[model samples]
Target: MQLEPDDSQSDRPVPSLAAPEFAAGDRVRMNALGRSRHPRYGERQAVVVRKVAANGWRVLFEGRTSLLTIHRDYLEKVEPV
Candidate 1:
């Protein structure tokens, strides 16, 4: 099922026009430097399962079946550590 944008945000933000960054199975980390922490920040370290759109991506945490749709701006590629 697709998610609906929050009604509280009356001024809808424009979607990014850039190309999708991460591919399926790519690992990513949330950029929490300037942005506020997400309610599900615990899943910041996740693997990209698919691209939702040019500006959105679907990611899944290790051992979790449910995937979350996250904005591209909030995500950064994770290098092997």
Candidate 2:
């Protein structure tokens, strides 16, 4: 089943406390804060930032090999090893 877009969330800015702006080659990890559709829900992953919009970010996950639009709350920045 496809989920419909919620108009109330359109063009909303991400809270500063939740997530920071990421560059093209930034490393990030998914937080285990809630149930996620991702297979690696709480694992570290490399991502290339396609774009950052007021609503959220468009990113490509290297590990999962999927491009996804995710909310800032679902991501957390991690330093590259």
Q: Against the unseen true structure, what C-alpha lDDT does each candidate score? A: 0.72, 0.64
What lDDT is reached at residue 28 by model 2?
72
lDDT by residue for model 1 over 3-79, one digit each (tens)? 98778875443344663388898998777531355655644578999887557889886677899888887777888
Highest-lDDT candidate:
1
> Which segments of model 2 are wrong by more than 4 Å?
1-18, 34-40
Q: For each predicted model, how many residue pairs clash, with residues at least 3 apart or on different chains?
A: 0, 0
Off by over 4 Å in 1: 1-20, 33-39
Looking at model 2, report the run of 10 residues with the lowest lDDT sum: 33-42
- The TM-score values for the models, in the order shown, are 0.63, 0.57
lDDT value for model 1: 0.72
Count of clashes in candidate 2: 0
